[model samples]
Target chain A: MAMKERLTKADEAKPWYGELPVESLYTAGIAGEKFFRSIQEKGVFLGSKCHKCNMVYVPPKIYCEQDFEKLEDYVEVADCGSLESFTCVHIGLDGKRLLEPMIVGLINLDGASTSIVHMLGETTVEELCMGMRVCAVFKPKNKREGAITDILYFKPTKQ
Target chain B: MGNRVAIVGAGMTKFVRRAQETGKELCYEAAKMALDSCDMNLDQIDAVALGTAPDTFDGVHMKGEYLSDGAGAFGKPYMRSYVGGGTGVFSVAQGWYHIASGLMDTCLVICEEKMSSYRPHPQGAFLTIFDHTTERPLKPNLLWIFALEMNRYMSTYGLRKEDIALVAVKNKNNALDHPCAQIAKAVTVKDILNSEVLAWPVQRLDVSPVSDGAVALILTNETIARRVTNKPVWIEGVGWSLETSYWTNRDLCYPRYVEEAARMAYKMAGVTCPRQQIHVAEPYDPFDYKELHHMEGLMLCGKGEAPQMTVDGITQRDGELPVCPSGGLLGVGNPIAAAGLMKVAELFWQLRGEAGKRQIARKPKRGVAQAWGDLMQVGTVVVVGI
Candidate 1:
């Protein structure tokens, strides 16, 4: 029988890397556009609430996770919501260095139970808190045509 | 149950940093090998279950459809499922469900991943896994999350960096006998410490290399299993659970999801105490520290004790619990979905006494394999008995 040989070891330590192309003017799906239009035109966000468990999902989902049942028609949500969690991002995944840091937060939209993830702008990291109330900011009517980008960011509302 | 499901045969392609074969071809190679191992053909399979990780790794959307024909799912009851790196074991669990549920008597379970397809770096795909609007802006690589967890683990247990490096050394050494290993090296603590740092506490050597490969298994019910082989490994129990996607809101030091899943599986398998009853374990180890993280989660040892046990050689092949006898993802290679199934295949071989040089000294009566994925939240567990 031939002698058994062991596997060879790998040499040459190499740095890990990845690349992605950047493009402007992306399109949102029809359903996604409809949801965004409500925010831009009426300052109202919509989501589907599960009748089975009373679990609300913001940025409406087609199906409910609790019962795996299809959701009912759209339910309008209040423009203001509480900040559930937030993070400050400093680096870009595409290896594209960023000039300024960006703040992202999960907002628990009012009248809906679940939090909707979106950009939190024009606020300092210290000013953001879990229970802080904030309202969605929409783009100018002339620039809005029903899209997620219609709400550029959510800013803290003055009580 | 009508019939008990067992994995009768398994096969894997060579794991490599890169492979010229397309993702479909890799699946075909492994599926063909698995079929050949059982002295069976694709036509004999009652169904097919395909498992793969993120679509970003392969640079193809709906990768399951692209891989269907190659996985021998053409015109068959086919379904694709994923739970991040847990996908491979989750695939096998789905196969077990089909056989146990009596929907199909025989199933071909195949898992394939080709991370090299993502140009520049595989790490880029990881950005999409985080909270897109919030976490993505931080520019954190996947390693940062693992590093944060590792730091927490170290602080909680007072463990040293060298203690964790031993896992890399042990797994890599174990890979010496594995034919499919991609970066199997005889590493030392110094070498690991000297390796380039990615995120603090996580070094280059501590992580598994991004690889391309596939692993396949043939699962059949008890009647068919007995007819095929004298010693068949039965899928005694399988369990999987997914935590809320809000990862940062929870503690990262311990994986409660894994503990829940393991408890469910152990209950079904009639295992009262895992540390004494389970002979082998293959917890997901994409990063060196993660192996320890998962070890504690599997309840192999009490919280804050795995790192100490690992340093004492308690996890070696000769130790009481021979963890990662297949060399693990840290040394063998990580193709995401394939790595998880590869651990199951290792347990199958160890239980059968067919592992050759990597075989454990003690007779493995029972084994447990687990995979974790999805922002470090989802956990999938499987327990096999000989």
Candidate 2:
């Protein structure tokens, strides 16, 4: 390898920053629409039962990821669930410290074979434990929207 | 298989958090260096196999088509494969089929990722990787999934954080000798334990850095490999497997997909026992715990045996079964696809006795490189030897 003298004067800097101005809107399919509308209208959780596989999906999908069978029958699930896994996030997406750490958990909702990822609120991260029973805290019936935000967060609940 | 295939040459750019070069420029640099290494020209290449992660990171859709000309694929039979993070070794597999199936005598495989193009943070692009209907509603980040998996793995094995931290300590230290290492440094278990936590059980140090880099490998049939170079590294076997997209349904403690992929590759390579047959190994380590997870997944050791192996210093660069002698994604940078090809390239150097200070003390012959990607759904494995 050969070495060359460094330029005493730096070259002019020319920089360009571009962004992709894009947005996406999705229509919740039959199963998804039923899953969300149930939460919004009834303040209750709904799941799709795949009778062939005997598997229930929380936040239901139209088809079973396992058997590829369409899931048409919807079943009601209890708001309470057991925490399968949890994480306390301290960093924000913008590479900054979050205003406050958030506790996120994967909860296996009652009667569902698959877990749902959601926020854990009304409890301290240090106090969070795997297998802890928690219940969804939903917005008031009059204020509920037909979106995931209808359920404000999950909180520790006494069995 | 139609014809035996081997890697004739490999090249990579320095792994960095950001690069001044564009994605095309990076691809050209790595391709040129790889061609130079084997004293071969683009005209000799019969096909091109390009591997890259999501277009989200590059902020460009159809990343393969956009990057083709710079990869020396102008007017050539070019194909691209995407398996999220597994695209690296998967590209090698794609090229292997090109030569092994007799469709092409010589194939140039290139993997590149320009993660720096994604603003705010490259990880922002990862948010949409979750199911738009269900998982995205919670506003989750990628680290959350890793943490959840790490927690499950640790809880199942009854392992301590200190024991898991050993992977970071070992890999980062080994990277000090790598020419393209990005965050190479000496660290201790105490340092890792004290590092700021990005997610519970996952600290800032546990993760690989966001990187912008490219890696290229020239693969050819046995005849061309023997004719082009005196020390050709034969790709003895290739295997890839994908788990269900329903990540939540599976037990996160073990990566069954990696094990299945390794089993297929090992069977093809005629190796009954991975632990005894494979000499040097490069398991993916995007997070420190992932190294151990993949080690077990690769069947290098029994389930829960990896932590003890780490404690026994068996995973050290000079150990009996040296893992990640290339510094891995953790010590090097994780440009997704590029990071995986870098491991294959490292195996080439190690087998060819050209790894310099990072070479294993024992001149081993056989090696394996594996990568995992996408909602923890896919595993890509490649077996190579001198």
Candidate 3:
């Protein structure tokens, strides 16, 4: 194999800098469209049930991953559920320190087989406890759109 | 040396400019169709082999894992293999080994690509494929390399652009008969010469469009294949080769790697006379000139002679040696790996006389499918027969 000549001086080697220079719009997929749209329009939670597999998925999908069965049956699940886990985040996506620590928790919605991660609100770490019930807090009707952020956060439910 | 492998089922989605389905969903549609085509359930499939374009195109990390369940590899021996464009054909070879080694009686092979996910344009992802220090400094895209290669091929044989335009004209016209074709139209050589020039010597009509689609096939050993379907297409031979990344050093006129890959597959299948023995061919045609270039490399025709054959109508559906009866990447679409496997699927459909309107006039017994990709480097070849 023949190798190209190496640069002998820094001045001789002028490097070029570039970025991807492209933006993208990804679809939420067959399951995600139904999942997000329902939240955006009605503030209701939807789950897909597979009759053959006897399983239900929160953030409902088009098919059952384990059984490979088509899942088109959508059922409404209560917005309130139990907290499975929690974490405190101190940094932002851009690698900067956040002004306030935010609580993120994984909550298992009632009547769903899986859990969804979301922001925890209206409570401090000192008051938060595992297995405690939490209810979803949706954004105002006018500000609502088809996205995960439509559900502002889950707060400790008055039990 | 090992148990023979045969393809029992095949399916594909329509190639399109954009698809609302995610990559995983694309895999599911194809996989489901393949299983249904052979009257078999997913439970009977023992293992899975998958191939697709690199993760860069979709901007998704660990894409193989994300698509695992979609390809029906859940709780099964699943493996992902990709050689850029060669990925589609190579996945079949991977599935063949699973059954041939007796490790599994049946294997499902899938190939998919969704270039539309790359946004603004899929070509942006190609910028990173270049050597960051060397080629990237020049800001060279895929078209730059292909344009350079096309010029070399044309000059080497004293061929004219009008001569190469016949391939585009023929393939697009043939694709009018294809069910899954994205943009199949009838155009004259004059139309090709008059199209907008993206790069010199490489016009808009001279290239295949960006597309999103997927294909899947079920491969089983001879014994199981006989039970699945009576018309099983055997995987006679499989071969792949990759050249150096430094495209500057290599001769641009001919694809040496493609020749080597074709020779390996031909030798394995005992094909001493490729031109005479191979009944049909489906060589990669991302660019109009690539079909002719690969035909020469595959030894289907003499170097620089593919143009004359095209002029003579020998590559048409009713001609003596029909090429790209499924419309190929040029006429149908180029979804990277999916397009490559699409050729293999075409061979299977043609061999079984199941290609509906796209069926060839002659009774072809054997066929070859080839794909080239990755920085003008790798070549993958597969030979299938009835």
Candidate 4:
């Protein structure tokens, strides 16, 4: 009787469920434009070297973050690098692991100051370990879209 | 600082997984309680500082301006500060500056987070917290980063899964005494290890539940504080810092930003040795391992000594250097920014000898509450005393 009396709202009426539609297109700006363009055209990695601090930033920056000086030198960085840290993930964004378990790693590119996070391919989770050398596998030139995705996952360079 | 600032009152809503009350309503409830506790009116407050995490979870843009009315911020010098998860303590820090700088005699700090409003699981909102161009394409579920960090921490420290499980057991048990705890349960290490693994190192029981809540603290200059309340918790020091957003660039084993922030606060608080000087600590513990990670960062002990401290009963409510006596985010809920403010409120209650059942066994003179967030970048620390 108490429960029935407490039911003021109709059972059929549901809480409103709506979404905030967000559509965003961001320009790479001065630094990112050059980095993505280089990946699109040359399939090479370019790091911006700060003259003041001498810190090279991969996926280069127009200005130095630390010293606030313009980064003038463009240095080439190798795609082959060592894995700093990694994890074997079983779940996707949908909350279910319908696909195979994926291994992702933070790969510090050679001659670059910062590491980039990307998927690890052509290797098993058991064999994956930090400090293992890996090289980037790029998508075919025609299919490249001037994005970080130009380099398809990274694979172990050696056992 | 021009003048000393102290916290005259504190208040918080019951942390829950979901709430019928909207964000503004939550803010109003906490703000009203804080004002009532100090026997002050809305008009008496000189300024207001608000803290809330990303707008993505609330589904409202410019949340500061939107929630201002309910937070008693109508036509006043209102400011909002955010550093991802560090927003709560950071807002309190901002409030302290308002009074200490002789700008405002009385300042109100309010933190609110309504995470339940985000549809399709609130974790879905965190998908955008990662790097949009490089990392977002990898399709990460927030758990991946936690698991990765936990794995790196364990491997570097030579720790087992059971070592960190002790934090979850202790915090949840401590939450049993909290009046507004969300998921306080007397769990064990076995229960945590047996819980379903969302990611490799992270389990269901090891993580704090998503929550909806708000907390408020009333800060005033020493003169105003003495007039407002007989017992006031003084804000001794505040420090905050952020590491590079390029999280992968640095080693995840140690939170350098947390250490830097703690060092800065300790220097200001005149705490030569945190382990001996600080009586209690509530470092951010959204994940069980994070508590241990933050203890190390706070210089409570050496790099790998936190897990052992938890194991040896040194961090118990009755133990020396009691940690997370308020049940922390693990036993309490994780509403992001609100969670941090809740820790600060616990310190206020604890220092004033007013925390009924959750009071520390050893009467504490000083305590530290800290928060860390933003892709493992930001650290906010506050030292409080009676």
Candidate 5:
């Protein structure tokens, strides 16, 4: 008999449930704090450069992964980026279809050796293309919190 | 037996309530200091062993892999050791087996913890350590467990609260000489008994503070040890024991698991008398009574007699037998895994005569460091000698 033929329907199955009762207050680390602070106060992107690895990391790190060298050289990264890849999610975490498809993009910021994954905005899935140029859409200055969400989403830039 | 293993270098960062650096950065700093201590780099290290507590403490899942590269494990054989809080000293055993098994010529052992990342207080994270089906519903935190154990130990031996409080006094005073000590204050027994009681019999002053830090050590085979440094502290023996998870059923007064683990290490180290052979001791002391509890488990004294040693000044650094000469988790700050390794690092420093002011009285021939954790279910012991 096929394995699929012996499957039980979701409604017929019983499962016990428990949630992890843990709340975290993570420190922004030395470099992460500076990066978030720069975005919150100066409205600039902060990055760290590893001279030994010849790599630049957006959302800077304290140490380089390849060489284990201390990465103290901070740089200002360009707010604009090129979309490396992206996905449009039709289903939500609760196993229900979303009212509107949410688009997420992996973007490589200028002067950065790495990319950041963030929500995409102002464009449909059909219009999204690889290597598409996008600019950061930040929230109001007064509402700025030291968090990645301070930049609401990435908007597609006009040609 | 496998090839003999020795710890050639040890290094650690200053223990703190909250650290500004990331977990990886803490690992890098300690790893670099350890490697630099022996004037060697990552090239000489064949592998890396990392030890850390629960992922909730740092808010990073798979913490071992995230913090591995910075511990000088880049493009090298890397492994993580875990035994709840016993991970720190167990990490040394991991490195020992690597070289002793003839797999790696040199291994770097690293332990790191950042409890401040947990919101409100770090103790909330330990709430999950209780059995979800049984104890979690009771909302029993660490203090409650220690209070229960302390009360049991006191009642079993008919000891006084004042006698138990002396352990805190002696350890905090010992920490005064340690540069990395966090809460090293010389408070009297009256102060401890008068301090705010979080749980009955478990005062605020009786407990170690939540902390963040990292420690690293370099271990190698006998052949490599000969060339590394003049004073290489040999790993005489290592042992660990884990009792059943049903801690409710066990007798709280005595830790049978600790005695079993200590006996195993003593057998391997060929020591019949721990009190006579072991020069110095560093037992886990997150609470004042724990130092005494673990000492009795390690067979250093009769059950309920450790407090008398503390009161008699016998455990003093200049006395007959020095215990927690590094201030232990009580005064040194407890970062879980990092605190355990801190004891082993103290043993290394003491055995090599490198511990400046905190060094014990005589030129010690041997020393033992032990760590206990996880609802009082496990005990890890490591014996080191010059």
Candidate 6:
């Protein structure tokens, strides 16, 4: 007689558990909303320049982190900056694809002391470097909205 | 402080890959055990602090609310605090504040995680830890970050992979004596080297396995502690600090946040030199290299000196400073939140001379448990002394 085989509960149960509700419209604070709007208008992405330390924050905030004091509005920043760090992702949550084999880089926006996280497009993994200059590519003017996706990605520019 | 706070009771469920009970049920089990150990009931707890890491694990938002009743927080002052893997010790630190501040005489602290609920792979939830715009686009696995840190540590210190593999071997060997250990095995550096590689340098054995479990502690002021138990482990100091979220911009070779937090904790505990003052330590070890990383951060040893101590057996169970005598996250299991609290529980047991076979050879007067979490930059430290 053939030996009997037993199945574990997990083997018998449903493979997938539950799904998280996905939403497109991510709500940001007033300061964050304005930062996104500035990018959509082709104006330099500006942040509050700390008068105390002369530090420039790319995403303008209500208060300075270092001094915990209210920040003053500053001028627009240049589009070009150098890449600080990057990684190439192959897998995603829920076995879904945001973009296959996408390369993401942390680009230090010009005129800002700190770097802003953004996608790196139209660049090969081998071409990426720590201090490579790149410029933000904005969406079409008609399709522009107050969102981070307004600036599609950063691409290497010939300086 | 009006009255000193001490952990009067501690309890935990059996750590496992998957549990038949739900997350709430696991919490209730641990809470019931803690209350039972103290000969007290839910009504005696003045406030409840629940700690769990990442809502992605349980597939529920505001997990504290879902677990409130089971954690004995119904109609009571309740707050949920989280700092990634450091959440468990952070929960205990919050509980200490309630008693020390004279706001509450007794507090029930619960730490639970149900990672098994995430089907197929718990690694799925880790994808969200990256920067949504840039890093997330790369689809990097959580192991990649640890691999990067391990590589940096190795290159800076000129350490070999075998030296780090010994940590996994020792920790797993120690877990054999723990009743709640999830993956306790007696293996060697060869076994670790032979294990499948997840990312470069980080093998399957080098990383902690995902687990589901719960741990709870009942803390009370000195007055209530005397009434509850003859032996109570006093919480001498608590400190926590967070570095910038810009982890990529900072040096990954060492954890400065942990060192800063440890300094604050040791100062309050009146510890002049941690090497001589601390008898045992439970540094967070979600990854094998993390144990060495935190050892330096906690000042148990100077920077770039921990690997030497491990190689010299100075960190062994019988050595000068027995680190992770509870088998740590490496051997025990990595349930994130519960893992940190489990370290505190180990100290409670060790200081009281109740660790059974896993007890250190030397008598312990003071023990420290530290945890690191959140984008490789937050450190939470707790000092408990007899």
Give all TM-scores, in the order shown: 0.71, 0.71, 0.95, 0.71, 0.93, 0.71
lDDT (CA) per prediction = 0.85, 0.88, 0.90, 0.88, 0.89, 0.86
Better of 3 and 4 by lDDT: 3
DockQ, every prediction: 0.01, 0.01, 0.53, 0.01, 0.51, 0.01
For candidate 1, lDDT tens digit of each residue in B244-281? 78877888788999999899889989899999999999
TM-score of predicted model 4? 0.71
Better of 5 and 6 by TM-score: 5
Write model 2 residue lDDT over B213-237, tens digit each, in one string: 9999999999998899999999988
Clashes by residue pair, model 2: none
Q: In angstroms, how far off is B64's CA in candidate 5?
A: 1.8
Off by over 4 Å in 3: A1-18
Interface RMSD computed for candidate 6 is what? 16.7
The runs of at least 3 residues in candidate 1 whose Cα sits more than 4 Å from the true structure, single-residue gaps closed, are A1-159
Worst 10 residues of 3 chain A by lDDT: A15-24
Best by lDDT: 3
Model 3: per-residue Cα lDDT over B1-386, one tens digit each: 48999999999999988888888888998988888899888899999999988787766777789888889988999988988888888888889889889999999999988888886788887888888877787868878989999999999999999999999998999899998999978889999999999998999999999998999999999998999799999999988999998889998999999999999899988899999999999999999999999999999999899999999999999998988888889999999999999999999999999999988878899999999988788999999998
Best by DockQ: 3
Candidate 5 lDDT by residue in tens digits, A1-159:
656654368866544345666777777778889999999998899999999878998879877877666789999999998999999999999999999999999999989999999999988999999999999999998899989999999989985
Candidate that beats the other on DockQ, 3 or 5, i.e. the better one: 3
Candidate 5 positional error at B348, Å? 1.0
After superposition, the stretches of candidate 2 with alpha carbons farther than 4 Å from their true spots are A1-159
Candidate 5 residue lDDT tens string, B202-282: 899889889999999999999888998989999998889988888778889988888988998888888899999999999
